[model samples]
Target: MIKAIQNIFSIPELRRRVLFTLCMLAVYRVGCHVPTPGVDAQVLAKFFEGTEGTLLGLVSAFTGGALERMTVFALGIMPYISASIILQLLAVVFEPVERLKNEGEQGRKVLTRWTRYGTIFLSIIQGTGIAIGLQTMRGPAGEFVVPDQGMGFILLTVITLTAGTAFIMWLGEQITERGIGNGISLIIFAGIVANMPAAIVNSVRLLRTGALTPLVGIAVLVLMIAVIMAIVFMERGQRRLPIHYAKRVVGMRNYGGQTSHLPLKVNMSGVIPPIFASSIIMFPATVANLVDVTWVQTLASMMTPDHWLYNVFFVALIIFFCYFYTAVTFNPVDVAENVKKQGGYIPGIRPGKPTADYIDIVLGRLTFAGAIYISAVCVLPTILIGEFGLPFYFGGTSLLIVVGVGMDTASQIEAHLISRSYEGFMKGVTLKGRHG
Candidate 1:
């Protein structure tokens, strides 16, 4: 493990990318503490403390406590994430966006531009709502979170938060272009990881104070590590479909027959479905809390973290989004067409439509299993945390993201080292791909 870390810095380009990523992440963490104007930081923190178990708590976790602090970056990258999800869903219905997605590089650029615009719009909406909510919100001690509860405060907050989100989005793009790993995932991963030390401290304090037993604390730690390893194993899993390309005669040289495999990930959509589902499910509750309407309040209460209704609905939404995202991202028809054009066919399947049907059937089964796995992993943590009052950091979605990203980043680094003739960490291990 130590050697692998050293090897990462041994290559000049990799070292530069790693350093650049770290610098950007440091910048983001720093910004998370820069308070927004007109908010009482102490009062905001108290308000968040009282708001535990609410949708705001979930938002706070994602923002790495920025929302509780009412920082300039309180909005974090969530508005951008919301916009991206919205645009992705729209791409399903909008012919133009769909065309752009299928148009290759230029189309992706256009779609990305549209997503940025949408992010700005979403930031305005979410920021304004949050500011207004803050104006009326009070801490547990009855202190006002926002002193200047007026249009000026709202507008200032709107501008600050929207601009902050836009800046964050730009930073992520820069990381993607000039740094290592995926920019957005790394950003979210950083936020999730940044709070780990505090969580551990709190857990230890609880143990010391007799609020938690040392044995139980140790058990929790062991469970967390086991969960992370499980997530890593699952995320790296895939289903490989064998394909044989028929020999074809060229003008002079023969250049056809070959056997290859199509790799379909066990979790094809990765962590996207859970993230999307959580956001969508929480949005209504967030609005309900902000608006203070009777029906909305009742609805929000019903969806509280540990409720059976909440878990059931949450699981269903997760499954739906898993299939929805998978469908959007992977097209069996396209794969089948490409394969048929290349004279590739599954051993016992006909080319064209039959191949597409067979692929879809296999995909559907794999996706069903994947959805079940994701729901179990994600839902179990939430249930345990809410019911048994465990640390929120040990929850399923967070665990999945941390583990998945770690595996992906490690795999990328392993590939780089192996390409340069170094034995990878798993060189002596079987190192089989997960589901495949």
Candidate 2:
């Protein structure tokens, strides 16, 4: 492992890319501390202490506590994420988008452009809403979060936040193009990781002060390790379906004889299902937080993370999105058609429609199990936090993002090392490709 780390910097291109990614992340962290104008920083911090169960808390986590501080980057990369999901969903229902999907690289570039535009639009909308909400928001002890309530603060906030989001969007795209890993995912991963030291410090403080019992602290540690192991195991798990390509003669040479496997992941949708579910479930609570009405407050309370209704609704949505996102990203029919074009067939399954149906059936079963796994992991932390006062980073979603993004980034590094003929962190070990 030490040698592998040394090998990474041995390649100049890879070294530069890694350093550039780190620099960009540092810039993001800097922005996270630059508070938005007109907000009381202390009051904002105090207000967020009770928001762990709300969508705001989740958003804050992704922003590395920026939302709690009312930083310029408080909005984070969520607007871009929302835009991307919207565009993907649009491709499913809209004819032009469907056609674009078939156009290959050029079409994807076009879609990417639209997604950027959508991101800016969404940022503007969300920024404006947040600005308005901040004007009315209050913290503990009846302190106003926003001291100045006027058009100037609103305009400044909207502009600052939207611009901040745009900058983050550009940073992510740059990292993806010039650096390693999925840029957006890396940014979120960085945020979650940045909070780790503080969470750890707080945990130790609580343990020393007897705020957290030794037994409970030990159990929390054990549960965290267990969950991480389970995640790694399931994320690497796959069902391999054998495929055989018939021998074919092209002129004088025989070319087509080959055997390969279509590997379906246990969790086809990755962390997306839980993320989408969180966003959807948190929307109402975020809006309700702005109003002072009794019914709205009740609704917000009911939707809190520890509530039965919230968990039920959260699980259902996670399951729905597992299938929904899987369908959007993977089409067995397309895979089958491509295989048939290349004269390949799944063993024991007829080519074309039959093969497609077989693939779909297997994917459906895998997706159901995947959904349950995601729900269980995400809900586990809610239980701990409610019962044991566990740290928010100990939550399933944060750990999933941390682990998933770390694996992805490490995989990219592993690929670079392997391509350069250097030994990886482990011999005969390869990270899963995008398809898997």
Candidate 3:
């Protein structure tokens, strides 16, 4: 392990990319501390203290507690993510977008421009809502979040948060272009990890104050290690579908006799399903807060993180998106067509529509199993904390994102090393990239 660490820096290009990624992440964390105008930090923190079950709590987690601090980065990269997802869904349903998708790189640049515009628009809308909501919000001790709330403060807040999000989007693009791993994923990963130290401090404080017992602490530690192991196992797990390439005669020379397998990862959707599910659920919570309807408030109250209704809906959404994302990313028809063109076929399946059908059936089963596993992994931590009284930090969605992103980044680093014919952390063994 130590040698691998040294080997990373031994390669100058890989070392530069890694260092650049780290510097960008440090900038993000610093932005998390710069507060926005017209908000009382103390009152805001106290207000979020009791909102653990609300949508804001989850949003804050992704923002590295920027929401709690009312920082310039309070809105985080979520608006950008939401905008990207919206455009992707539109590409599927809208004809023009579908056509544009076929245009390749140029078309993607056009769509990316559109996504940026959408992000700014969402930032303005959400910033306005949040500004108004803060004015009406009071801490548990009757302290107001915003002392002077008006159009001026609202506009200021909107501009600050919008600019912050836009800068973050630019930063992510830079990282992806010049650094290692997916920039957006790394940003979110950094945010999630930023809270780990504080969570640990809180847990240790609880133990010292007698709020958490030694046995419970030990149990939590054990469970966390177990959960981490499970995540590593599941994330690395894949079902390989064997493919045989028939012998081909080209200019009296034999070719195309090769054996390979298509590997379908267990969590094909990765942390996307949970992230999408959580983001979608936040809409209702945000609406319920902004609009003062009696019935809506009552319904929203029932959808808290601790509520059964919320968990059920959360699980359902995860499963739905699991299948949805898998479908979007992997098209069996295309795969079958490509395979047939290359003279490859599944051992028992025909090389036309039948192969497509076979692949679809296999994918369906994998998707279903993946959905269940993701749902269990995400929701189990909540149950452990709520019912069994575990610590604040547990391996669930956050852990999944952390582990998945870390492995993905490391794999990219390994690829760069291996392509240069240098051994990496995996030694002589090849580390598969995220898509692989």
**Backbone clashes, each candidate:** 0, 0, 0
lDDT (tens digit, per residue) of candidate 3 on 18-73: 89989998999999999998898888887777667567888899899988899999
Each model's lDDT comes to 0.82, 0.88, 0.86
Give the distance in Å from residue 22's predicted Cα in candidate 3 to where it truly belongs.
Answer: 1.6
**Candidate 1 lDDT tens digits, 318-363:** 8998898899878899999999989899999999999999999999
Clashing pairs in 1: none
What local lDDT does model 1 show for residue 4?
68
Model 2 residue 98 lDDT? 89
In candidate 2, which residue ranges exceed 4 Å CA deviation? 141-143, 388-393, 427-436
TM-score of each: 0.91, 0.92, 0.91
- Cα displacement (angstroms), candidate 1, residue 36, comes to 0.3
Which should have the higher lDDT, number 2 or number 3?
2
Candidate 2 positional error at 356, Å? 1.6
Among these predictions, the greatest lDDT belongs to 2
Which structure is stronger by lDDT: 1 or 3? 3
